[model samples]
Target chain A: MKEGKISLEEVKHIAKLARLRLSENEEELMTHQLNNILLYMEKLNELDTSNIEPMHHAVEQVNVMRDDKLKPSLSSEKALSNAPQQNGVFFVVPKVL
Target chain B: MTEEITQWSIIETRRRLAKKEINAIELVETYLKRINSLNPSLNAFITVCEELALKEARYYVDHPDKLVEKPLGGVPIAIKDCLCTEGIRTTCGSKILESFVPPYNATVVEKLLQAGAIIIGKTNMDEFAMGSSTEHSYFGPARNPWDTSRVPGGSSGGSAVAVAACLCPGAIGTDTGGSIRQPAAFCGIVGMKPTYGRVSRYGLIAFASSLDQAGPMARNVQDTALLLQVISGYDPKDTTSILKEVPPYCEEMKKPVRNLRLGIPKEYFAKGIDSSIEEAIRQALRVYENLGARIVDISLPHTEYGVAAYYIIAPAEASSNLARYDGVKYGFRAEIPSPDLIHMYLETRSRGFGSEVKRRIMLGTYALSSGYYDAYYHKASQVRNLIRKDFEEAFLTCDAIIAPVTPVAPFLIGEKLDDPLSMYLSDVYTLPASLAGIPGVSVPCGFSPEGLPIGMQILGNYFQEDLLLRLAYIFEQETGLSPKYPSI
Candidate 1:
C-alpha cells in the first residue's frame, strides 16, 4: 500500500464491493485512473481540519416529517414496468442460496 | 421570419402568443424544422418529440381559451435526459438505462408542463451527469454550435447547445460541480444553478445528491429568470426543499444595479486563466463600475481545495446513490450465467455503467471503505465546511461575486478526454459556488480571438437568486452581448 497508490488487487476489491465486475483490461485502467485521482486528492490532507465539523448537507435543514396517513404510490404494474426481469408481480433475481 | 421566431426570448414568445400574432403550432413547427436540419451536425438532442410537441401546440391553438395567461404558452423547451419524463426514455447517457422509460415526470417537468411549455425533446448529457464534457455520452458528444470541433461543456452540454443553436428557446439542465453553468458559458448563453433545495429534486436521476440542482438555460437573463420562476417553489416531495417563499425573479430583473457591492475574489484571478477571458471579465467589471456598482476585493482563501473536496464528496455520494441499480431492479441487466445474486449484481453494474462512472464509483468505494473513511471523505467534508464559511464571510462585504466560469475557454473535444485530472481541473472556477450551495448565473460577456464565447459567472448568497438575476439582467442589457447566437 504505497501512499495514495491504488494497486490492481485493491481496484478489484473495490469493484467487487461496488458490485461491478471489471475485466482485466478495465481493472488496469481503473487502477491507473483511480490512483491518479487519489494522489491528486491528497491535497485535502494538507488542510488543517482539526476543529472543523463535516458537512453532510449543503443547506442546513431539520428532518422533514409528514403524517403517517396512507398515500398513493406507484401501482405494482407501473413499478414493474422498468424491471429488467419480472415474474407476475415480482422482480426476478438470481438464486441467493 | 423563421430564424427570428426561433431566436425570440421566452418573454417575447409569450408576448406574441398572448397577442395572437403567432400560434403555438407555428412556433413548434419552426423549431422542429430547425432541429431537423441542425441536430444532425450538433448532436444536441437524443430524442425529438415532433408528434407529441405538435399535438400539444395544436391543442393550445385550437383551444384559444386555454392560452389566456399561461406563462409559457406553447413555448418548446428541451429537457436534459437525466430527468424522468413519463413514457419517454430517460437514458442518463448510459447503456444501463438505454431502454428504461420513466413512469412519471420530475417535479420540474410537471411544473414546466403546467406553465404550458411544450416538451421539445430530451437533450443529451454526460452519462449520469458524471463528466464535464459531453464527449462521455453514449450517444456521442454534442458539438459546440460555435465551432463544431470544440466541445460544449457538460453534463448539461446538450441542453446548452440546444438553446445556443436555437433548436429550443430554453432548456432545463442539472448542475453538479458546474454541469449547468459551465456548459452555459461554453455555449454563450445564460445558465443558472439556483440555491440548493430551491427546486425539488424528487424525480431528477441522482448524480451527486447534495450538489445536484436543476436550473434554466436560456439565451438571455430575462428568459432564464422566467423559467426559474416557473420551476422554483417549495415542494413537499423533496424533503430537503426549503419552505421559503419563492420570490418574483422576473420582477426582480427590473431592479437597478445601483449600490450593489460586487466581489472580485483575488484568488479567482490568480493564475491559469486564459488571458483573453480575463480581459473580457475585466471589461465586464468595468461595465458594472460604470453602472454605479462598487467592486470589493475579497478572499475565499480555501478556493484552491474546492476541486479536490468536490471530487471526493460528489463521488462518495454518487457511489451510495448509484448502488440501487442491481440486476433484479430496473435498468440494464447483463446476459450472463449468474450463479448467485452477487454475480448478478457485479455483471449488471459492469455492463451498465460507463468508464467515467465506473471510475467515480471505484474512487468512492475506496474513499468510504474501512481505514480510509476518516482520511478522505471526512476530511473532504470538513474542507467543504471551510469553503462554505469563506463564501459566508465574503458575502458580508459583497452582494455577489464575479469570476470566470472556467480557467480556459471551451477546449477541443478530445483534448482532455484521456486525462481525467485535467478534465476535473476545468471546473475549478465554478465548483466553489456549488460547494457553498449558493445561486450562480453564467452570462456571456465576450468572445475569444478564436471566436469561441466566454462567460462571466455571477454568484449570490443562498436564497439570493433574485439579486443574482437582477445583476445578470442589468449586465445583459448594458452589454447587449447575448444576442450574438452561434452561427450553426
Candidate 2:
C-alpha cells in the first residue's frame, strides 16, 4: 500500500484469483504495465477528500420493490440455450470435489 | 439509387417506404450490397445480420399499413455487439463469447424491433468494452473509415464507422468512459450517453454497471434525437432504471439557444490536448456566440484526477461484473483435459480474454484485494464524488459545459495500442462527464487540418439529454457540417 511497485509474484497471485492463466512473459509485462498505471493513479492522492463520501451510483437509486406475482420467465430450456455444456435440463460442469 | 439509398435517414426511409418510392427489400438490398463491398475495407461489423435484416424489411413490404404506427419502420440500424440479440451471436468482441447467442434481446434492441427498425448488424468493439480503441477486439480492429490507417476510437468504433461510411443510417452504442462519444467524435457522427438510468441496461453484457449506458450514434443530430426517443424509457427489470416519463426528444430538441449559457471548463483545455483541437473547440464556441448564446469560463478543479479515479473505479466494477464468464453456463470453454474445476476456470479465462481484458482484470482484482481496497478503490470513489460535485457547481452558473471530446484526433490504428496508460489518458475529457452520470453529446464541430473529424462535447446536468440534444442540434444545423463518406 506504500507507493511500492507490484511484484511479479503478486501479479501471478492476482491473476490466479481472477481465474486467469497468464504466460510467464505476460505476467512480467502486466506487472510492469500495472505498476506504471497504479503509479499514475497515485495522482488521486493529491486531492484531500477526507470529508467526502464514496460515490457508487452516480444518480440516486432506491432498492426497487415490486408486488410479487407469478410471471412468465425464460423457460428452463431457453435459459440453458447458450450453455457451453449441458445435460437435458441442466448445465454440466467439472466435479467440485 | 445505390449512393442515395445508403444515406437515407430513418425519417427518409420511413417516408420512401410509405410512398412505395422505395420498398423494404430495395433499401435492405442496397445497404447489404454496400456492406459487402465496404465492410471488408473497414471491418466494421462482427456479424451483419443479413438474413434477419432482409426478413424484417420483407415484413414491412408486405404490411404497409403497419408503418403508420411504427416510428422507425423499415429503417436499417447497427447495434454494438455488446448488446444481446435473441439469436444473433452477441460477441462482446471477445472470443470467449464468440458464439454467444443470447436467448433474449437487450431492452434497447427490443425497443428497436418494436419500432420496426431492421437489425442490420452488430458492430465490432474493444473486448468487453474495456479499451478506448477497437484494437483490442478478438475478431479484428475496426479502422477509421476517414483514413483506414487510423483508429475510429472505441469501444464503439465499428458502430461509428458503420454510420460514418454511410453503411447504416443510425447505430446504437454503449459508453463506459467515452466508448460511444470518442468513437463518434473520431468518426464525425453524433453520439450521446444519456443520464445513467435514463436508458435500461436489461440485457447489456455488463462491463461496469455504474458507468455503462447505451446511447444513439447517427450521421446528424435529429436522427440521433429520433433514435434516442425510441430507446429511452424505464424497465421493470433494470432496478437502477429511473421511473421518469420519456420525453418527446425530437420536439424538445428544437428549443432555440438564444439565452443559453455554455460553460467552458478551464481545466479541460490544459496540457495534453492538441493545439488544433483546442482552436477548433474555441472556433465552435464562436459559432454558438454568434447564434446568441453566452460563453462562461468555469473550473472543474477535480478534472485532472478523473482518469486515475475512473481507472480504479471502472476496473473494480468490471472485475466483479466479468466474473460471470467462468465457462460452465455459456460461452467458450478451454479444451484442456483437466478434471479440476479451478484449472478449467483458469484455462477458459486465460484463453478466452484478450490482453487488455486480462490487464484490467488483474488491475481491478489487485485493487480490490486485501489491504489495498481502502488505499485504491475507496480513495478513487471519494475522488469521483469531488468530480461529480464540480459538474453540479458548474451547472449552477451555466446551462451546460462544452469541451473537446478527446485530447487528440483519432490516431493511427496501432499508435497507442502498446501503451495502455497513454490510451487511458486520451479519455480525459469524456471520462469526467461519464463519472458524473450526466448526459453528454458529441457533435462534429470542425475537421482537423489533416481532415480527421473532430467532435465538440456538450455536457449537461443529469437527465438533461433534451437540452444537450437541442444545443448540439442548433450547432449542427447552423454549421450544416457532417463528415464526408470515407472513400472506402
Candidate 3:
C-alpha cells in the first residue's frame, strides 16, 4: 500500500482520525469504496501543473477589517438553545480531563 | 385565483398584490394547499412552516404600501434545508441536525424575508449538500414531479421539485459542485449558482467553503433574475463577499441579446455525452443564432480532470467544515458511548451521519492526512488553477459560455447509489465552472425521450449575472417551454 492510500487498516485509521467508528462490515465496504475513488482521483495526474501556483481561495481577498464597535450578540440562552444536552448556563458534554 | 397561483411569478404577484387583484394571504394559501396535497407523494419539503408563512402573509394584508420596495413581495418561496432559518427546524437533510433549530437565519434567508418573500418551507436535500442525488437525505429522497419513478438531481432536489410543481414561485439552493444546477436541470426549472462571494454565506451551513454558493431557482429566467437581485451584494459578515456594487439585474434583463458571443466548449460536447441531450443543446443554439447571437466553438482542454479535482477539493473542505458536529455542539449528540468524551464523539458521529457523509469524510481525511497532503490536496489545487485559466482564456473571446448542465438526464433513484464514482461523473459539465469561481445557470432546454427534463448550462464571468440572465431570458422567451406545471 502507498503511504497515503487506503487499505482496511488505513480506512479504520482515517475513520478514527475523523472521529467516526465504522462497523467491521462498514470498514471493509469503505475500504473498497475509497480505493475505487482514489483510483479515479488519479485522473488529475494527467495534467502537468509543474509551474502553476495552487489556488486556495476562490476570490482574491486582502485584509478585511471591520469597525470594532459594540454590537448586540446572541445571548447565552439563545446560543445554547439547540444543544442536545445543556444546563441553563452551559452546554453539557462528557468529561474531557 | 387558483388558476393564477399556478403560474404567478414574483413580478406578477407583486403587480397583482398592488392592484388588489389577489390578497397575499389567499395567494400564500393556494400554494400552501398545493404543497400539502402534492408533498405527500413528492416529499419535496423537510419542514413546512405553514403558521410562520401565514403570519408573514398577514403583514402584507394591512400594509400594502410595503410592496413597492419589496420586489418579491407577497411571493411564496421555499428554502433548501441547508440554509439556517431562525426558529425553524433546519435539518440540512442529516440526522446530525435532525432536531436542530437555528437561533439565527442565514443571510440569504434574511434578505428574502426583508424583500417581503414568505418562506413556505425548508426543502429537502442531500445530507449536508453532499450528493448528486437527493436520495442521500435522511428524511428520504424527494421524487421527481415529472416522473415519480426517476430521481430529482440533487443536493437541491427538493427546491427544484418545489418550484417545478408550483408549490412555490421560487426557491433558493446552494451549490458546491452542481447541487443547484443538476437538480434544476432534472426538474425543468431555472437554477443559478452565483460567482463565489457574490452572495453572503453568513449563516449557511458550510459544505465546501471555497466552492459553496447560494443561488436562485424559479420556473423562468425573469423570476430568477429578480430573486438574484435580492440576495446579491456585499456583506461584512462574510469576509470573502466582494465589495463591488450590484447591478440592476431586472433592468438589465430587459436589454437586447443581439451580437452576444456564446462559446460552445468542445469538451462539453465530447463523445461521452448523451446524444439526445447534445441534440437538445444544438437546437437551443439554433434558437440563439436566430435571435442574432453568434456561437463560437471553443475548447476547455482541462475539462476531463474537473470531477477528479473537485472530488479531491470538495471532500477535503467538507471534512474540515463538518468537524464542528461533535457531541459538544448545538446539533444532535448520541448517548450510546459514555466512558469518555472521545468515545462519545466517535459514537455520535458514526450514528449521526449517513453512509455518503462518512464516505466524504474518509476521502477528505485521506487526502489531507500526513504524507499525502502534497500528493492529493495540493496537486488538485494546482489542477484547479489550470481549470480556472481555461475559463479565463475562453472568456477573452466569448461573451458567455453556452453548454449542457448535465451530460445525461436525471437517472433512477437507486441506480448509482452503490457506485459513488458514477454519481460523481454525472457532474462533469457543471464542476469546472464551480471550480473556477465563475457564475453558471441551468435553464430548461429540452426533455429526454423518457420525458424527463434537460437543462442548458450558461456560464458567465465572475459577478456578471446580468449578462447570463439576459441570455437565459432571451432563450426562455424564444422557447416558451418553462412556467408550465408538470403533470403531478
lDDT of 1 by residue, B1-488 (tens): 99999989888888898889999999999999999999999999998999999999999999777775688878999999999999888999888888889999999999999999999999999999998889989899999999999999999999999999999999999999999999999999999999999999989999899999999999999999999999998898999888899988889888999889999999999789999999999999999999999999999999999999999999999999999988666888887763688887887888888899999998888999998899999999999999999999999999999999998989998999998999998899999999989999999999999999999999999999999999898988988898688776
Model 2: docking quality category: high
TM-score, per-candidate, Cα-based: 0.98, 0.99, 0.98
| Candidate 1 accuracy as TM-score | 0.98
Give the TM-score of chain A in candidate 2.
0.91
lDDT for each residue of candidate 2 in B287-351, tens digit (9 for 90 to 100): 99999999999999999999999999999999999999999988999877756789889999999
Residue B462 lDDT in model 2? 89
By descending DockQ, how would the candidates be arranged? 2, 1, 3
Clashing pairs in 1: none
Candidate 3 segments exceeding 4 Å error: A1-5, B1-3
Q: In model 1, which regions exceed 4 Å deviation?
A: A1-4
Q: What is the Cα root-mean-square deviation between model 3 and the actual structure?
A: 1.4
Please list all clashing residue pairs in model 2, or write none if there are none. Answer: none
- TM-score of the first chain in candidate 3 relative to the native first chain: 0.89
- The clash numbers for all candidates, in the given order, read 0, 0, 0
Error (Å) of candidate 3 at residue B302 is: 0.4
